[model samples]
Target: MTTTGAVLRIQLLGPVRAWRDGAETALGPPKQRAVLSLLASRPGDVMGVENIVDAVWGSDVPRTAVNGVHTYVAGLRRALEPGRAGRSSGAVLTSESGGYCLRVDPADVDVTLFHRALHAARRSRGQGEAGAALRLYGQALSYWRGEALSAVPGPFATMERDRLRDLRLTVVEEWAADMLAAGHHAELVTELPAAVSEEPLREKLRWLLILALYRSGRRAHALWLYEETRDLLARELGIEPGADLRTLHEHILTGHPELLAPGAGSPLPVYPGGLPPGTPGPVRLPPVGRDFVGRTEELARLEEVMRGESARGGPTTPVVVVGGTAGVGKTALVLQLAHRLVDRFPDGQLYADLRGADPERGPASAAHALEQLLGGLGVDGARVPADSAARTALYRSLLRGRRVLVVLDDAHSAEQVRPLIPRGPSGVLATSRRYLGELAARDGARLETVGPLTAREGTRLLAMLSGRRLDERGPAAERLVALCGGLPLPLRVVAQWLAANPGAPLGALLEQHPALRTRFGPAEAADGVPTGQFHVIETS
Candidate 1:
């Protein structure tokens, strides 16, 4: 576990050591190590300098303790990064307004990963994927070698250790539940009683042991185990078993078939029609219309707006709005651009589907979108305001001074996006079917209009989608491109149809769907204007 680029490997069950690269790095007396450990435990959160000083020196800190804290952070960074040549951008420790944050990747920390995996397992169980839930729960439990933060000696260390121990016990209960769901009652008979012994106060664990015993045909032992646990709880804690546990005991006594139902013996609590509890990745969008083809130049231009030289000249709060007709690839271009520039905003990248201008639903309220964005940024539910104006104000306030990238996809108009625009030195990219002229004039946002793909680009796009050499197919590819009207969405749809229907001929496809020709428009340009028509292909 490294904190702020410093390689720190701690074995609470054994020795604790800090290293820089391959060499041992001393943690400047012992007080400094305690301060570093506390900060590392909560990554990405700003810890005030004064609070850190007080933590390390307690009431005995000198008048210059604040300066000492700075020196300690600087030393820790140097130790973590060695000569500093390999220091990552933002490093492990970063300075914010009135404090500093440890920016360690959560995956690199064992405790963090353990908690995350445990949460994932519980969620999987809720989703009715018992096999996946069991695997995840087992993997989470495997991370525990011994007591957490064991080698570290301090009040904070003791508190953290106890917290982790409790969390581990909760995970153990989840594990037993997953095992029972997987129909391993006989195997759990031996395992669950030992777990109950380790965590005697937890009624849930005791309940699981009784259920496992009853299912394994040890009825007398199961009842005896329940009595023993109830007596211990009453004597030690002056409390009765929880309602769930008592209910399970009574069901076992009555020979209820529920006790024999698959997964009934598990102690996993059920959520009340809520989303599964776990760390979920971003939602993936399904493939929209495949008629989309070509537009290489437009794609490149949008890329330039995001990462090219043109993007730098915009206002401090740069805005790039892509507009086009329905099915014109505005959202596609914006999505592609955002994916490419994800690394640019190390702070974070945010995306929202405003669903504005959609055929089914009217435009989403600015206040609603603001609420979603605020929630995504870790704002507590109670802290979010109810009013639109207040929400917008709070959203902008939160965004101020942060270098984040915001993508509002499928917006209705500039009016819908204006209030949603965050202030400060951030970048805002929006997509709309309508040309937002006022946004360009007032907000100095650049507008990029996506047009139909060129003939060659359209052919290439079809070739890419079909996974075949279009040149080998000759006039058929050209005819198909022209038939699709050089529209990417249509071309993709036709290509998918062709790919799926492998035995069909391109000529037959064109002959049966002559309407495609009219959809592509005329071949020749009228006057000096280019023909908007391209060759058409049957999609529906």
Candidate 2:
């Protein structure tokens, strides 16, 4: 009988190697080894001879490819089970239904073990087990002895080798970030430069190297590295360093305290809800209104402001305070703009309701607002500082070099909004009932007053929300818009009531909810300008 009782171990991670019963076995020529590697990639999965030939030779297929496959299989069967009769069926590599399946346990494959360990490492990191994650990462990295699938011939092997190399780099980068967070910068200082040397164009690796050096008290070296990177990036790609690298350089120059390593015995920050580093940041913008209608002019103006000083050829962060009476759709307008411009801000878009108009809760204190904002930034609640000023400083420091959009809804005052504003190139869009003139004068915030929709826009909004075939020019729609004073909230409420109770007339709905008709009280804006003959209903 063949020596098949012992478990077979296959290593496809580095060079193709096989150990049968703890002894290395000859795997034949390169094509035969390529065939074995493909099967090992998916242990126990049946692979057809045609598919194998295609993967091995790609377009330059040989005329005797099928015969060549049979020859390779015979060779593998003889090497893997020398005791089997020449004409007898093989056990380790079996042929069934015109396809071959390497019937081996997946755990015996080094690639499978590597992937499993990497997954576990990410899980541990997400659970705030930084020490465990570091250990697991090291275990996963230990699987790679050199380039994966080294010298294994085939299109499949080439593609898989590239993919595996990329995964290795990703794990390395994530490990470096966790190391820095856990105050192990000294370890990274020794390891990261080698990785950077191998991937000189990868800015993130260089960024981590600089940060690790800085935290390890090599400030001069870190600065020199940044300048070196700037020159390298310019020379190779003909472009300047990205926003993140530039921001990190600036902070390093000033010796920003936020860049300092975590204190001894302090807990390392968990992955943002366990997400892998470099994963997209949290998307916190509230859902946009489905039946939101016009505001072409208003949307364009806000978009320009949200574009920050970029559009104006300046270098200041943009803060636009949307001021208007309640129920005028200021929040809706800003949220819509934020969603449209989401692709521009890859870091994240953060939102918080300041509760400026919440009579029960009153305006949320600046300190409370900063806490909520920090939470969106992935800061652990317990880690937040108690002092308001310290929290604000931390908040600003976290935002350095990131392109985030901060949307503060229903803000109370300039003071309440100021502390929550993000630093650097991030933009802020805040809505408030108050005009916040003080904000404009002091903080250079551009004030955009949201007024009631025009009669046409309001009529269209009602039709869309109610899904009715109402005549845009009909008296019924005109009276409805005029009674609602072109304010989106009351119009929406009336439309929803009509939609829910299909037979309910607009008049009957208005009579039941008299608050819907309260918007026609004044034609004055919050700052005393004539705001057309529109009524305003305060919304929570």
TM-score of model 1 relative to the true fold?
0.42
lDDT of 1 at 26: 68
Give one digit per residue, the lDDT tens place, for model 2 in 1-540.
123676788898888988888889999999999999999899889999999998899989989999998899898887777777879767888897877988888989999999999999999999999999999999999888888888988899999999998899999999999998887898998998888987898899999998887776555456557767877888999999999998897776344556767874432232231122345676889898678898899898778767646344344678988888778888999999899888767778899999997878789998998888878866667766687876676666556666788899998888899888765678888998887888898888999987888899988888887768456667777778877788888788767766787766656654543455453454455566455655453543
Candidate 1 C-alpha lDDT tens digits along 1-540: 444455554323212345455577666645566666767667768899877876666667789888877777876666555555544424666778888887766555566778789889989888999889988988987877776765664566667778878888888888897787677988888777777777788888888887887677655455556656666888998988789877876665445677773745552231111111232323333334443445567767766765652246333577898865544467777766666666665456677788875556788988878767766655546556677766665566445445567889878777878888876556778987666788999887888866667767777777777757355247778887666666666777767777787787667787855666555444343223343444222321
Give the Cα error of residue 455 in candidate 1, in Å.
1.4
Candidate 1 regions exceeding 4 Å error are 1-296, 299-315, 380-383, 467-473, 517-540
**Which candidate has the highest TM-score of all?**
2
Tell how far residue 352 is off in model 1, in angstroms: 1.5
| C-alpha lDDT values of all predictions | 0.66, 0.79
